[model samples]
Target: MKDRIIDCLAYEGKVSIKCMSSTEIVEEARKIHGLSPTATAALGRLLTITSIMGYELKEKDGNLTNQIKGDGPIGILTAVADSNGNVKGYVGNNTVDIPLKENGKLDVGTAVGKKGMLYIVKDLGIGKPYVGMTPIVSGEIAEDFTNYFATSEQTPTVIALGVLVDKDGVRTAGGYKLSLMPDATEDIISTIEQQISKIEPISKMLDENKTLEEIAKLVTGDENIQVLETINPEFKCNCSREKCEKGLIAVGKTELEAMINEEEKIEIVCNFCNSKHIFTKEDLQNLVDKI
Candidate 1:
């Protein structure tokens, strides 16, 4: 199915929830970055959360960035998203693999490492960007973001991310985030607490062909969940040869001239989507002339 993000309210509209089915987006990342099973899970989870956070921004031009640096084999994980839920990301090492956990699932925590930090930067087309950070509680993306919400943003949130990678590819990948508003009552909160304890992983439910509304009701324990909006999320990169020209010009005329004398051409590859933008000798000389 196509990727989707659903916004909803439950418990008498006192709680906010975001649910995403990111199978297609995650699979695209796996193909772009050539990620292994473990790296696919890590980047997939990070990308989904980044998209949700991006969609939360109010401005059309706003953006959100998340960086997770852990002391594990997967290295650093970076994801960025725009207000329209266009997400893209890359991993430090895309081929990381490890033994499965005792639970017979991918060992995401061990692959991500327990020591590191989660840094989130939100540029909402405002005077200044907002930055929040917190120590990583677990390299598992969900728990780390959960800690970030409580410690950095001071919002109590429950986050669950999961990716099921079979031999064919990412069979399923998705996640959910639920946050309580200040006005939420005790009974509503307790009801959610009870339901979350018994719910399956988000990816598992998606793999079973569960709809976003069904998952929302299942998690919030409120059958009358209010659906607010539906959004399509995808892996997208905004890079072009024109942007590369600006980057080359920023190096100044002298640097551009030197580049022309020393090399046949320069290639700018986007880290997010792996698209190549090559600047030939003629292009370099033209840039120097513009200076």
Candidate 2:
């Protein structure tokens, strides 16, 4: 299935679940970053969870930025997403590789190193943004994020993120986040916990061709769920040469003059997408004149 996010309510609206099938988007990211198998798993999981969290912002104009810093070979993992589920990000090291776990699973925790912090920044296009942080639990994206929601955000949450990669590329990538609302009862929560234990990994569900609707029903133990919204998620970058030029102009006349005088040309590359923009010395001179 194409990349998409589905929002639904379960247990008669006492709980909320968001499911996503992000294979296409993750595959695109893997190709763009030239990620190795382990790095692909690490970054892909971050992108998937970030997309789900991004869609949670109630405001249409809001955006969320997540940074995962650990003491591992992967370095820092950063991703940004809009309310509509469009996301872009990059890894500090895109070529990290390591041996798999005994279970034949990618050793993301070792690659990510189970130390450091998970920082979240929310920008609603209004007042000052909100920032919250929590320590990484396992350096596994889902576990660390789950710890963030429970400890930092005070929301009881369960998150599952997975990416299956091979020589071809990302074979399967997706995740699901389930949260218990304030009105959720002890019995309902217990039921959900039991169901989660029985359910397969979110990626395996997607690999089985399980639709979001079915996954919602299975998780909530409610055959009748209220489908709130269906949205297509994409791997999109907001960077442009114009934005880079504006940044260059903001560096002040002195810096611009120095760039013009010392360098024949300067190239600015976007962090979100590795798109490069070249500015000739003449271009720098024009900016200095405008200054």
Candidate 3:
């Protein structure tokens, strides 16, 4: 199925939930970065979670950036998502890979390391954006995000994120987050927990072709979930040649002149999409003249 995100409320608005099955979306990330299986899983999971979190910030005024900086070989994985479902991210180490764990599962914890921090920065489109930091709980992502919600946002939340990658590339990537609002009752929380505890891994569910709506039904149960909206999520970058030119101009006419004299062409590569933009000497001269 095409990748999409679903928002819902359960127990008569006592609980807020969001689910995303972003196989195609995450596969695009893997292809863009040429990541190994382990690296694909890590980046895919972070990208999926970041996209869902971005929707949570839409009611506010700005953007959201979620960064995972670990002591493992991967160094850092950073994803930025906007209110409109546009998301982009990159991993500090895209080639890192390790042996699987004893359970034959991707050793995300070992790859990410137990030490480091998960930083979240939210821009409200006004003054300064708010930043929050929380120590990593389990480098496995879902637990780490859960810890972030509990410690940083002070919301009782459960996050299940997963990404499965084969030798070919990412096969499936997606996740679900269930949050208990202040009005949620103890009984409701207990019931949701019971359901989640019995379900399969979120990634496996998606791999089996489970839709976002189906995942929600499994987690929140059939009775309480109220599906609100569904959104198609994809890898989107806001970088282009014109934007690169504008940036060079902002560096001032002196820099442009130096580039024109020293280098035949100025090359700029986007970190998010790896798309390269080249400005020839004539192009540089035109930019300088415009300034």
Candidate 2 total steric clashes = 0
> What is residue 187's positional error in candidate 1, in angstroms?
1.5
Instruction: Note the residue pairs that clash in candidate 2.
Output: none
Sort all candidates by lDDT, best to worst.
1, 2, 3
**Tens digit of per-residue lDDT, candidate 3, span 48-82:** 88999888787555678999998899889999888
**Alpha-carbon lDDT of model 2:** 0.90
1 or 2, which is superior by lDDT? Answer: 1
| Residue 51 of model 3, lDDT score | 92
Pairs of residues at least 3 apart in sequence or in different chains that clash in candidate 3: none
Worst 10 residues of 1 by lDDT: 147-156
lDDT (CA) for every model shown?
0.92, 0.90, 0.86
Residue 189 miss distance in model 2 (angstroms): 1.3
Stretches of model 2 off by over 4 angstroms after superposition: none
CA displacement after TM-score superposition, residue 46 of candidate 1 (Å): 0.2
Best by lDDT: 1
